[model samples]
Target chain A: MHIVVCIKQVPDSAQIRVHPVTNTIMRQGVPTIINPYDLFALEEALRLRDKMGGKVTVLTMGPPMADESLRKALGLGADAAVLLTDRFFAGSDTLATSYALAAGIRKIGEEEPVDIVFTGKQTIDGDTAQVGPGIAKRLGLNQLTYVAAIRSLDLENRSIVVERRAEGGVQVLSTGLPCLITMLEGTNTLRRGAMDDMFRASRATIATWSAQQAGVDDIALCGLRGSPTVVKKVFAPQPRKEKAKMVETAGKSDAEIAQATLDTLFSANPKLETDLRKLAAAS
Target chain B: AKKELSEHFKTYKDVWVFIEMERGKVHTVSWELLGEGRKLADKLGVQLAAVILGPPGNDLKQAISDAWSYGADLAYVVSEPLLKDYRNEPYSKALTDLVNTHKPEILLLGASTLGRDLAGSVATTLKTGLTADCTELAIDDDRCLAATRPTFGGTLLCTIFTLNFRPQMATIRPRVMAMPERRDAKPGRVIEFKLSMVEDDIVTKILDFVPDTSTEEAHLAYADIVVAGGLGMGNPGNFRLITDLAAVLGAEYGGSRPTIQKGWISADRQIGQTGKTIRPKLYIAAGISGAIQHRVGVEGADMILAINTDANAPIFEFAHYGLVGDATRILPALTKAFEARLAVRRMAS
Candidate 1:
């Protein structure tokens, strides 16, 4: 079984800050890491590969610097890594992105048949969660998204069962092999790489593919020109009129301060006190 | 004020909202989108329509009627056995067929798991643009759909427009918009469509469905009051203080993303841009630094109270009230205060 896991290199969103005066994202000092959601997908792929005796190849579409993320995936026991990078791929939206990635996957499939494809539930930067399904549609593969767990897999029968998270319930779905899955976050933890694997990752040569090398025949569908959605404008959300009103607690005990705070809250919205009483009583 | 439309997009009209239903109950986000779609349709001088796809049953009929009552001027429904449960293949094919035949200018769907799965496939098949998790939607000066969504993890908001696409599509999370007031409106027109594909064409099959039986599931999005903690809560043991305070107020409890990463709280109970968006009457955030991601999720609350030891935490910038102290101590104190106050009320009543 050849399993391909698609990952993305995204800015560490936790450390990202907006400029107070300009209202622009401060991307200069923000460090980049593998998108957190994708790690779960990669780990699940590695585990499946370990059990089923197969290969796991990490795939990413980004600038040249994304090679670091691919290397990190290799260090975590992936067999190989592919970086799909090109100047024409800049400003690609989810639709254009999935198109290029699908082309690359097709190229990979030509080398060796891919039985399964994995991606994160969503990326932190875009938070769109569209590309996974987009790739599935383009490739005509069965799409299973938001998968919480893989219950069973039969290689001879070429069937897999997964527990997919739906609204308020979990759907146990069975599908044929060569399907695409977007793994949910918090489903699995990434394993620590061995020292030898880390050393190998440092020296491994990643296969870098341009748009053409990835079998993208249509240049029109490669970048900004191919994207249908246009960003008309970007700005910061309007700040509230005033900062939080501090409850003075310098000399007061914790209990006293708590009572004072409740008094202030109730006084500000008189109906809230009665509402809270009813809610508390019911509970 | 409308701009000249291209020849390809000239015939596309009306704003469509996909009414999502599962287990015989319609998701509330469908009605919220209908409420929003009405405003956009009225602005563009077009009709508001709801698109429903499911098996033929009373549940589907109720959804159609509810769509009209909520604000849909008309509804397009496709009922077939293949659509009984939301398998991507049949649902996307049915929806895509309807969109092709009707040619809607704008399509809105909830950003739920099923909706996202269907929307992505349908939009890709149609080769159109889809913006996910849009916070705001409006008719622009040129009469295009302007979908505003948080980007770069809620630090900035970008307005996206699908100019060349005939059917502009977008998804919004549940509770992001106010629930529309249901009214006694006349039943809208229903246009029924037929699915030509059979079950054999589908590859994926549903083996079983496990409904969430745990009564303790977090209903954070629709909670009246909410209490959340962050890494500053120190450890998983201290995270219980949030639950304790919430219990006293009869509020739902959640945590920041970091807390979820640390296993202090379940992923479903995470309150941030990538988690759940909540709009409660009152939201009390404890020990959270209030990153923009977390701020956007809870900013819709009517009142926000932030408690932290750091007086300069970003949460205080927008929170309605601030308590500069350790949440470990303040949470228990607040819990006691509420408990006593409620006991006094209970005795009086």
Candidate 2:
């Protein structure tokens, strides 16, 4: 069996600072890391590989710098890495993104058929959680999102069972192989890459692909032009109408301050009084 | 309508909330939206309406009456067998078709799992503006919908406008707005829309409905009191400190988005713009730095209490109460105090 994991390099959102002068995002000197969510998907893939004995290939669509992340995935035990980066793939929304990724996966299939495709539930930056569905729709792959656990996998029968996290509960689902699964975060830990593996990842020649090379015939559908939705603008949020009323208690005792704070809070929002009564009863 | 909004949006004129009823049960968030829709509708001086899409012969008519009592001026429904279960393709096409025929100035949807899925596609198909997980919705000085939500990882608040777009779109997280009282209990106009698409046309089948399983569901949105921890608590194991305080107060315990990002908790336990909307009576944030994205998710809480080592942490800006102290130190103290108070109460009982 052949398994593929799609990873992307995302700017460490925690360290992203806004440029003071232009108010534009400052991307320079900011470190990039594997999308924290994607690591869960990669680790799950590696675990399945160890149990089932399948080769794991890590795939990424990013700038040239993204090779850094691909190598990191390889260091963590991905057997191969492929980077699909081209000027045309820029400005792709979820739809366009899925299209490009689907084409790249097809190219990988030409070398060897992929039994399972894995991805993170959603990207922190996009937060749309639509790309997995979009890719499944386009590639005709069975789509499973928010997978919490791998209940069972019968490779001989070409069937896999998973627990998918839904709105209110988990669904025990069984589907055929050749499927795309987006794993939920915090389910598993990523393995450490050894010094030798890290060197191979850093030195590996990441197969690069352009739109045509990746089998995407329609350039229009490959990137921004193909995307139906456009983020016309990204701006700062508006300020609140009023600042919070700070309850000052410099010298008061903890109990006294707590009482005063509760009183002031209830006075501002009377419903809070009723809510607290309800909580107290529940307690 | 804007020069770029979909042709369908050009014809939309009033405010409509897609009254979501899943599994023969009405989502309570619909009522909260009715309360808000009334304000947006009144501000626009037009009718407030609801779009009910469900299977036929389900007493959806009663759902219509409830909408009237809740504040809808009219209810448009597409009742058919194919509409029984929500399939993205069919539902998107149906709602898009409705917006085209009857132009509404504003469209509201509960920022729910189903709502988010449908709204993203519908907004794209219509090519209009959509703001997801909004904390506040109000009529601006110019009478346009000013959608306020947290951005930039929950550090700041931003208000978005569609400018010239009509049928302005927004999704509010569940429990963000207050559900008003239903006094009039009147009936609104009900118009039924016939479904032409057959089930065969739809590709994906329900197969089955899988509900969430975690024993502790995050009630951050509606909890009377919430105690949340952050990375400042240090290791993932220290989250027990947060739960201890919550246990004594009978409150829900949550973690900032970063906690989930750090694998300290599941996404279900995360609190922020994309995670969950919590409007508790009191929200005590421990060790949280208060990024804009995280702020958007929790600002609905009636009162915010911040306990962090940094006095300048953005969480303090809007928190109702502030303590410039170590959360690792203060959280334990809070837990003990609440435990003592609860013990006193239990003995009295």
Candidate 3:
């Protein structure tokens, strides 16, 4: 079995601070992290590789600097790394993104048929959980999203059963291999690389592909030209109209703040009283 | 101020929201977009339309009628059985074909699992710009759809401009916009057509759909009160404090994206920009640092109560109420309070 894990290099959004006065994104000195979500996917892929015995290829689409994320995946026991990078791939929306990535996965399939593909539920920056499904759609792969756990995998039958998150309850779905799985976050722990693996990762050669190399026939379908929605503008979220009405405990006992806060909350939303009641009964 | 897709946008003319349906029933979010689409259409001075793809039957007509009441001026109906269960092929093709034949000024979809899957593929096929998870949409003075969304990891918001692109597109999360009241005695126009395709013609079969199930998963989108944990919950063990409070409140629970990243909670329970956006009437955030991403996801809540150890944490800035205390201690107290209240109700009953 061959597993391909798609990873992305995202800016450390937590560390990114907008200059308090200027409002400009302070990019300088801000470090980039292998999107934390990708690690979970990579770890799941690696764990599968270890259990099932196969090579793990970590793939990404970003600038040349993205190779760092791919190498890090290699350090964590992945067998190969592929970087889908090109000017054509720049400014691609989730749609174009899926197209390029699907092509890359297709190319990897040419070398070795892939049995499974793993993606983080979504990217922190895009916050759009569309790409994984987009890739699954374009490639005609079964998409298992919001997956909690892989209950079992029967390689002989080419089937895997997984617990999927749905609107109401967990859906225990059993599907075939050669599919795409978007693992839910916090499902598993990603192991750190040992010294030997880290050294090998530092020296591993990464495969880089452009549009033609990745089997993309149309340039228009691979970038901003292909995305259907347009963002006319993005600005800071509007601030709330009123400042918080801090609950005051003044002149009362030490317990006043908590009680006062609850009072203010309930008074503001009459339904909350019923909700609290409903909540109590449910509990 | 600059248009992002200026060179190619003039060709689009109508506001189109994908009316996603399954097993003959149009999803609630479809109607939600129509309510939203009505506003955009009026702003753009265009017709508000819905692209309905489903199996041919009574369900399609009912779905189209539903769209009409939801403020859509027209319904572009493509009927086929293979399009029924939402395998990407038929739906994407049908929607793309409709877009090519009748150019639209904008497209809107619900940011659900099904919507996200189909929208991405159709947009790619049409070769146009697509924005995901838009929090707000409006027609600019130029009559262009201004798509406002969180970006750069939700650290800052970026307004994307597909300036010259036809059919500006965006997907909105559920409950972000209030559901407009439907006119019961209302009816509108629907154009019904048979999609010339079947299951055999489609390449990928609906081999199966595997579901993710966690007893703790609450599908928080519709929860009245959401109790979510954050990195401040300390170790993974401490997450139970949040769950205990949530269980006591009888609310679906989640954590900030950071908590999910920390492996303290499953991604299904993550409540943030990359996870789920909840508009519960009351949101109690425990030990979570309120970052822009987390804030954007939950700010829709009517009232937000934040409890974090750090007095200066960003969570306090926008949180409706702030309590500077250890969530470990505070959560237990809240749980006990709710538990006792619930007991009283049960005994009274």
Candidate 4:
């Protein structure tokens, strides 16, 4: 079993603060972390490799700085890390990004027969869960998305069964191998690397592949030119002008305060009482 | 460079909305898209069509009539057993085959779980662009579809244009578009099609379906009132306050993404761009600092009341009402208040 997990380096969204005066994104002092979602994917891959002997290779496509993310995956017990970086891959949207990653995965397959590919359900920044399916389509791999758990994997039969999350229920699905899986978030807790694993990860020789090395032959299909959808504009959301109307709870107990607040709310918005009454009757 | 539609692509006409149905009922988002698609079709001087794929039954027939009432001029029906359960392979193949044969210029689908799963594969197989979770859709001056969605963690909105693609594709999240009035219109022209694939061809099979056990199955998108918590709740134990308040008000309860990550709430209860988009009459958010992700989900509420310890929580900026206090204490008080008020009203009546 040879598993390839795709990861990304993203600015810590929690730390990203909007400027007070300008209301613009404050990118300064925002540290980059290996996308938190991808950690779950890496952990799942490592668990699979531990059960069934195989090499887990981590792959990412970004600037040279993205190597840090790959190294972090290595520290978490992945066997190898590959970075696909080049100016040609810059300004790539999800489509172009999937194309580059697919090309990189094909090149990795030459070294060993790849059996499975893993990716986070989505990136925190892009918030688009398109790349995983796009890669699966490009490679013609069976896509098992929003997988909650791997019920079983029969390597001998080249098959696997997973619990896929869907609307209203969970579908127990079985599919063939050489497939792509995007594990849902919070499915498993990522493990901490042992002391020795961290040392080995620091010494690991990372493989760096340029666009040509990654088998991307068409220049037009590698960057902005390959992206059909263009973002016309970007702007901050406008704030509503009205501030909250505070309920005067002065010298009142919790119950009195609660009653007072409701009185004021109902008085100001009389329709609320009628709506709630109708809902109560219907229920 | 000004590009013209290729002669082969220029033949593509009509706007199509994929009517997402399961069991017997149609998803409301499908009707919402039809309402939006009708406008686009009218602007382009083309016909509006609805695509229905399900098992052969009266349910399919009812869906076709509902589509006409919602604004569809034509209906494309593919009744096959292979498409009954929505296996991605057969559905994508079937939808793609219909697109290739009929050549609809614009395609819209609900951004539900089934729609997202099918749209990705179909768009990729057809080598076209698909904008997911769109908040707005319109035809630009160039007669091209402009699909707008939040990007960069919902901080900014971006309009995506599929300039080179023949059949532009987009998925709109539920409640993003208002439902159109269902009119009493004549039945649409039905065009039946056949799917080539069979059960044996699909690699993936649904062995069993485990229904969710939790009783909080009220459709969050259509809820009348909502109460959501955020990381400010401090820990999982405090989430019960949200549910207690919701119980008194007959409102649905949810939380921010972090609450789901912390295992305080289930993914289904997450109120954000990634989870459920809600448009309730009254939304009470406690301990929520209101990130763009959470804001977009509840922004459509008719009235927003935010309670937080921090005076400068971003939620207060957009919220109609703000309370600068701890949610732990405030939630229980609010719950008791609403409960007492209701009890009094019941006694008086």
lDDT of 1 by residue, B92-184 (tens): 998999999999999999999989999999999999999999999999877899999998888889899999887999999988998899999
The interface RMSD values of the models, given in order, are 2.0, 4.9, 4.3, 2.1
The whole-model lDDT of each prediction reads 0.92, 0.76, 0.78, 0.87
Please report the candidate that would top lDDT against the real structure.
1
Top-TM-score structure, candidate number: 1
State the lDDT of candidate 4 residue by residue for A1-283, as single tens digits.
9999999999898676667666566778889998888888889999999998999999999999889888888888999999999999987877788899999999999999799999998888877788898899899899998889999999999999999987778899999989999998888999999878899889988999999999987878877777766766555666676777776656777667666767766887899987876665455
lDDT of 3 at A256: 47
Candidate 4 at A165: error in angstroms?
0.5
Worst 10 residues of 1 chain A by lDDT: A16-25
Question: TM-score of predicted model 1?
Answer: 0.96
lDDT string, candidate 1, A1-283, tens digits: 9999999999998787778877677889789999999999999999999999989999999999999999999999999999999999999999999999999999999989999999999998988999999999999989999999999989889999999999888999999988999999878878999899899999999999999999999989988877888877778888888999999999999999999999989899988888899889888
Question: Best to worst by TM-score, what's the order?
Answer: 1, 4, 3, 2
Best candidate per DockQ, number? 1
TM-score of each: 0.96, 0.79, 0.82, 0.94
The TM-score between candidate 2 and the true structure equals: 0.79
Residues A130-236, model 2: lDDT tens digits: 66656665676666777889888888988888877655666666777778888987788778887898888777888888888899978977666665443433455
Q: Candidate 2 lDDT, tens digit per residue, B1-349?
A: 2236457545667889999877676777888998999988888888999899988764576678788889898999998777776656678778988887787788999877678667766765565567666778888776668887554454434566765556688888788889879868667778877766786665444555666566568455667788899999998988888888888678988888779878787767788766777877689999999877778777777678888777788887778777776667667776666555545555665
Worst 10 residues of 2 chain A by lDDT: A228-237
Give the C-alpha lDDT of model 3: 0.78
